[model samples]
Target: MTQIDRTMSLVRRAVDERISQAIAERRDEWSDAGPAAAELLDAAADLLGGGKRMRAVLAAIALSATADSARREDVLSGRACAGLGAALELYQASALIHDDVIDGALTRRGLPAAHRRFATAHRGSHWLGDAEAHGRSAAILLGDLLLSAAGSELGAALAQCPQGTRAAGRAAFDAMAEEVALGQYLDVRTESLPLPDEGADHAAAGRAMEEAALAVVRRKSARYSVMHPLLIGALLGGLPPHGEGARRLAELGEATGIAFQLRDDELGVFGDPARTGKPAGDDLREGKRTVLLALAWQRCDAGGRAILRRVLANTRADPAEIAAAAAIIEECGARAAHEERIDEHAERARRALEALITAEAGLSRSATADLASVISLLTDRSA
Candidate 1:
């Protein structure tokens, strides 16, 4: 098997084991608490059971690529890489839990969202007086618990690393967490505020909003999703701090991370509800100020502008209005523009790979190919 394949396999196994352990621990802690605890455990398990494992895979690949062949076997066998992968995966879980709460989403990964599921079960059994309130409370606590667990795992992983390597990895991980939170703040702020004045040229205001949205996407979704995890792995593998390989990874990471967020935005607008586990045009429903929306709003004239304002103002717009909004977005050529951006980002990522191959003599050709393949797979995914 290729190095990347081996790394991904190992990382998946590690994440699965950690998730199982977490569930067992949670169950044990609340064993006497009755069904609520059990429900929470089940909810967490459902979320953990299936995911792309992209972040964990990236971590493993980064570490494996930098380690010497002889030491690579030892690192993979020693549990250090697994610990790191598991920690990163847990962090992802925490983020998802919180994201569901923020979005008020009802489902994820084809299952009822953690909060909704817990709330419904509580209400059904007459266990809680206020089902919705109880659900939200439970989800918040559960998300916090998961975040703490992730920190513990990450600490263990760092302790296992060789002396000098831990510092860099920890620093990168910390920055990633902080940046994502800030980005989320920006996103929430944008939604809570009104759009800029229509009198000030609707297109100009829309363009400004798109810029703001992209900034958030870069910090919140891109950095933490792919770049930081990969960098952490590279650091743990004891690669030189500023070597050609390290530089290449950074360049490639930025490109792939941006592309990943763009794809998610596309999915938000157009993905199947059944497959995406989200409502159709959910971003529109949320009034999320994405590039797609910005472009569409910009291109509309007075009538189109009026239609957009009315649909967006309604918290419970009908399907026809939603469809009209989507149509206006498409008619404005925003969809094509966003797609073109995705392609541009993908090309940049590929260029980074090419730069790595050209500049670094020590990097294995197979490793480079594997990295490129994984990037392509992620960037080109439909769901």
Candidate 2:
């Protein structure tokens, strides 16, 4: 197998093992609950079952690239690195559980959301007060549980690392968790704020909102998703803090994260339900004030502006309204603008990788190429 393929295989195996271990641990702890606990376990298992494993893949590759070849004698010896990836995945699950509650989403990955599933089970079992409240409350607790589990798991993984490498990994994991929460807060706050008024200083409001959204994206998605994971891997691999390879990885990660988020935004708006596992135009319905939306609003004319407002105001927008919103966005050139932004980020990421290879003779060209390929795949993905 090619290096990328081999790396991905290792990552997948590591993730599977971690998830399986997580399930077994939870099962052992909750065994007395029997079938109900089994159901919850199943829910938890389902939650962790499938994903792109992008963060995990990045972590493994980053460690492999920077670690001394002698140290990486075995793939599983990189458990600390894989643990970082598992932490990210668990963090994603926690965020999604809470997000489903906040957004009132019914399904995720073609299954009822955690809250809904818990609530339904609670109702059937007759062990609760209000079923809905029970479900929401339970989901909240479960999210917390998952987050805690992620941390504990990360600690376990880090424990296997040499003493010199453990601190750096811990620092990265801490920053990732903290930053993602702050970003999520910004996003929830943005939803409540009114859009810019007609005759209002459109430029000011649009810029302000866009900046806020961008900041949120940076913290909530980009930094945690790509930058920190890669950083942790490099650190665990014994790359010095100011090493050329480490610095370059940071730059590459930032650009990759931006592109990754932009792709998510695009999927939110344009992705097919079958592929994306989200309803068409879900972002619009959720009134997510994305950078793309802000750009569209800024460029639209008066009539187009009115159409945008109408779409946003409708709580239950039909397909026609969604299409109209999309059309206005396209007509105003926002789609092209968004695409340009994606390209810009992708180029910056490539440049960062180039700089790394140039500055660090120890940096493997094959590893750098693998990262570049991953970035290309992310930027080009449709869903």
Candidate 3:
């Protein structure tokens, strides 16, 4: 494995241990509540157990990017960074739990989604008014529990840093929560709007669609997933958002995040089920208004545009229509355009990382190089 891989592996081990600690404490704290409480904690653990732990690693990268003269070892082992990786993982788990319910996704990472699992359990117990409703309600509460858990752990992480640094990091975390909630609402609003007529003001509608799609990425994932994590890590490392090295990290984070989500948008429509652990054309079937689809609709002929609209309008699309939609996406070259955008963002992130190497940040040469590799792995991922 590469050096970054090895380091992340070790970091993952640490983070997992911290996660276990969070679970254990919660389990005890809620012990008086009943067995149902245990189930919620278990659900959170199940969701947290898997994945690449990319957010945690990105946070680590930001923490390490401060001046080489800073005490690297002390920072890594200190409270400011401690439990942070696990905290991020928990926060993500909470988001996914709610996301699965919102999207009506059946599975996550090859397992039944949390609500589905809870519904199954409710059905098996034979004590529910509506098993599915029960499951959804439980999952919502479970998501709330996870948010609280993540916040608690984050508070602990901040406590280990200086007061100024702690305050700044906490602010970033708070802003992240607010932005993601608002972004999700925006996404819901956009999805509910009527489809525009291709014959009337097609150019203007297409432009508006593209703008809306990019806005989703910007607010929902770019800042929430990548930028805030970097800012929080940098703050913990003793630099505010405008601090030395912070701007570069922020720029790199935004670019990497945009590329990352764009890659996901591609995979949602084109990824292999076995590799991605999800059904083929899942996003297409769900009528996700991705930038890819918007661009495809923009360039396709009238007949092709009709097909696109027909498939998207049918949320219960069968395999044949899903296949047809995928074909249309490719034939219109929307996939290529989306990929080109990914390449652009990836290059931007690469340049940002490279510039940081010789910049005034004074990051250790080894840490700087490892960060470059990390950026590559993040943007170039397939599954």
TM-score of each: 0.92, 0.93, 0.94
Backbone clash tally (model 1): 0
**Backbone clash count for every predicted candidate, in the order shown:** 0, 0, 0
CA displacement after TM-score superposition, residue 264 of candidate 3 (Å): 0.3
The lDDT per prediction is 0.80, 0.81, 0.80
Model 3 has an lDDT value of: 0.80
- Residue 102 lDDT, candidate 3, scale 0-100: 85
Q: How does residue 283 of candidate 1 score in lDDT? A: 77
After superposing candidate 2 on the true structure, give the runs of residues whose Cα lies further than 4 Å from its correct spot.
Answer: 67-73, 76-78, 123-128, 313-315
User: How well is each residue in 1-383 modelled by candidate 1, as lDDT tens digits?
Assistant: 86667766767877688668867987998899998678767877788888878888788777767556666655654577778877888888888888888878777787888889879978888873899988888998878877888888889888988889998888889998898899888888887888767688776788888888889888888878878887898888776768887788888888899888888888877787767777777777777778777777777777777777777636587888888887877787888888888889889999988997787635545456667987887788778
lDDT of 2 at 33: 84
Residue lDDT tens for model 2, 237-345: 6778677777888889989898889888978888888888877777888888888888887788878878877776356889998988889988889889899989999
- Judging by TM-score against the true structure, name the best candidate: 3
RMSD of each: 2.4, 2.2, 2.0
TM-score of 3: 0.94
Q: Which ranges in model 1 have alpha carbons more than 4 Å from their true place? A: 1-7, 29-36, 68-78, 242-244, 359-362
